[model samples]
Target: MKKFDVIIVGAGLAGLSCGLQLSSKGKKLLLLEREGVVGGRTSSYNLDGMDVESGFHRYIGYYTHLPRVLRKAGVELSEIFMWEEKIHVRVNDEKPLVLGMAPLFGMIKTIKGLVGNRRYLSLKDKLSLLPFFMNGLKDYVMSPHKLDQHSIKEYAAKYNVTNRAFHHLIVPLSSGVFFLPPERYSAYVFFGLLAPTIPKFYKMRVGAYLGGMTEVMCQPIADQIIKNGGSVRTHSNVESLVIEEGKVKGIRLEDGQVYRAQHTVLAVTLYTAKKLLKPVFENHPWFQPMFQLPLMPAVSFQIEMTKPAVPIDVTTFAPFTCLSSFAEQSRTTFQASKGRLSIILSPPEKFLDLDPQETLQFIIKDARKIGLDLESNILDYRQVNHEYDFHSLEPGFQALRPTQRTPVEGLILAGDYTRQPYFATMEGATLSGLKAASLIK
Candidate 1:
C-alpha cells in the first residue's frame, strides 16, 4: 500500500504542469499515467533516426504558460527558437494572407472578407467593428465574462461580416485554436486567441524546442516530479475510480491492484472521466448533464520525407484540405539532420475516412497545392486519430463542463478538457493542471 499527499493522473501537459507546481512545494505526489510517456498530445516519436511530433505545436511566448513551467523545471529559454513574424494563411478562393506585425494593415485584412460578402452585412454593420478592432483587445480582456456565452459565428454575424471573413480568417484562426468548427464554438474561444493578436509587451514569436517537444518539455517535468519525492507509474491502466462514502478513496487498476490517495485528479478525457467516475456519476444530479456535452474529435497525420518537399520555411495556411494551418518542422525530424524533410498534415473529417494510402495521397496532393514537391519525395508516414482529443464546446456547452472542483470532495478534474479559457492547447492543459493542484489541500 502506498499513500500520497496528492495523486495526479494522466501525464499530459495539464498533469505535468500540476505536478511541476505541486512538486516544487514538496508535496508527496504520485503521478499515474496509463501510457509509458509524459507528453500527451504534445509529445513526439522516433522513426528511422527521425524525431516526428504528434502534431504541429507552436509556442507563442506571450499566450502560452508552458514557458513558465519549463523555466521552473530547469528548461532554458534560449534552448527554444522564436520566430517573431512567420504566420501566413491561404483560403480556398482568396489570396494567401499574412498575419504579421503591421497594425493598420492587419486590421484592414481582418475585416475585409466580412465586408466583401454582399448579403451578410450592411455598410453600417461592417463599420461598427472598426473602433473595437483598432482599439485592440483591452476592453475585451477586461470583460471576458461578457463574451463567454457568445459564439464566434454570432459575433461575426452581429458585425455583418461575411462567411469569407468567418471561414477563411476567423474560422480558420478559431479552428486552429479550438480544434473544432468555428460555427459550433463559443465566441470566448475566439476572443481568447485574438487577445494576443493585439500588440504585446514582450516579443511576439512562434517558438519550438531545440529537441523534440517530448525531450524538451515532457521529460524535464517528469524528472522534477521524481526528484521532488513523487512517484510516477506508467502502463498502470486505471480501471475505475474507487469511491466510498461519496469520496474518492483510491483507484482500481486493470490488474486488480488498488492505490489509495487523499485526492484524485481525473485528468483523462471527458469520456474517460465519465467512465471512471461512473460509480458516483450514476446517482449524482450534475453527472447526467455532463454526459450530454459533445466531445470534439481531432485527427492528425505526419509524413516523413527523405528529401525537402516544401521550399517555404513554414506556411501557416494553405488552400488545400480542411486543414486550417500547416507548419514546416525540420528541427525535430532526425531526417532533417541527414538532408530530409518532414511535413505535418492536419486535414479535416473528410480525410479521416480515407484509407492510409488514400490519406497519404490526399496529403501529397494538398502539399503540391502549397508548392511542395510531394511526388519526388520518398519516405514513410504515421497517423494518430483520437476522438477525445478535444471536447466539442458547442452552443450551451459552457454550462455543462465540469469545473476544477468535482462532485467528489477528494477528486478534481484536470486535462485540457476542463473549463479553461483556451481549448485543445498545451496552454489550456497546463492551466488546468495548475488550477487542479491549487484546489488540493
Candidate 2:
C-alpha cells in the first residue's frame, strides 16, 4: 500500500478546495473523485455539442471565501462570471417586479423598485416585514439556535407578516432558493446565511458563470493541485475508510486497492457520507447526526430555442409553478444558449416521477400562465435529475450539522451540509473545505 500525508475523497468543490489549501502548505496530497470530472454539484458536461451545467448556480456578492479560493487557483471571478444588478419576480397575474440584487448596498435602488411595484407589496405589507427583519438580524447574531426550532412560515406569523408579503416574497425566496416550501424551511438557516452577507453587501454582486463550471472552475483548481505536486485522480471511487483503533488510516477503493495516509477527509455529499460511515460509526455521537441529515432531489431543464426567449441575464422567479426559477443563459453564459432557458423546478417531489416530455408539458403550461408562451418556441429540451441532491435546510436540521473536526483521529469532514454559517451554497461548500484543511496537523 502506498501512503501519503493526506488522502482526500470526493473531488467536489469541498475536496478540491481542501487539496488546494493543503498542497499550498506543502502537504503531500491525494485527491480521489468517483465521477470522471470534478465540481460535484457545480460540475458541467457537454451534451449534444453544447455545455450543460449541473444546474443554474449564482455567485452572489456576499460570498467572501469562494472568491479567495478561486483566486488562489488563478481563476478570476470577474473573468468567468457575468454580473447582474437585479432579479425579476412574477407573482400570479401581477406584472413582474424588479428587485435589486444587493438590497443593502443599493438600498435606494431596491426601495425604488419595490415602491414602484405597488401591487406586489403595498405600504402596509412592506411595513409588516420590518419587525421580522429586525428580529432576524438580532437573533442571527445573538441566538440563531432559538430560531431553528421554527419554520420560516411559523416565524413570519409571529411577526404578523402580511399574507401578501408571505406569498409574494417569502414563498418565492424559500422555493426558488431551496426548492422547499416556506412552512418546511428553517428560519435560522435562512437568516443566518443572510447575516454574513450584510458586511459585504457593498462589494457584492450576483453573477452567473460565463461557461461550464468544470472547465472554468473545477479543472483550474485541479490543475493547481497537480502543479503543487498533489495528485487528483478521477473515477477513483472509495469503498470505505480504513479505520484502525477508531482512527482513519486511509481509504480502500472499490477495486480493492488500498491507499494509506496520515489523514483522510470525506468531502462527499451528506447522503454518500452516511452510506460510507454509518456501518462503522453508527453509534458514535459525532456520526449520529450524519445519519439524520435530510436529503432532497433536484430537477432542472435546459431548453433550446429558435429565437431569443428572455431578453436579460437576470434570474427570474415565478413561484407556485412547476418552473420556480429560471435564467436566459444565452444572454449570460453561452452564445449557443441564446434564446434558450435554464429552469429549476421547485417542490420537485411532484415531478420526480414524470417523464421528460410530461415534465416539459407542465413547464410549458406554467410558462404560458406567466405570459411566456414557450410551447410554440421551436427547440429541444433536456432534463437533469439528482436523486439525492441537496441537504435539507428544514427546521431543526441546522443543529444536526457536524463540524469539520470529527471525533475520530486523523479523519475530517467537509461539505455544505456540515456545520457552516452558510447553508447549501457554493460559499458554504468552499468554506467547509477550508475549515477541514485547517484541521489537518
Candidate lDDT values, in order: 0.67, 0.85
In candidate 2, stretches whose alpha carbon ends up further than 4 angstroms from where it belongs are: 47-50, 103-108
- The predictions' CA RMSDs to the true structure, in order, are 4.7, 1.7
Listed in order, each prediction's TM-score against the native is 0.84, 0.96
Instruction: Name the candidate that leads on lDDT.
Output: 2
lDDT of 1 by residue, 1-441 (tens): 777788777888998988888888888888888876778787776745545666767776566577788888888867654343446665433435555432333445334544454333456554655643543254356755555566767767766665444555565566664555656667766666667645552455566445677777798888988887788787878888878888888788889988888988878877788778765678777677667777766667666666554444454655335445665555432325423343334435555567768877776676566555565665666666665666765555665666788766788889887877666678888889889988975
Cα deviation of 381 in candidate 1 (Å)? Answer: 0.9
- lDDT of model 2 at position 262: 96
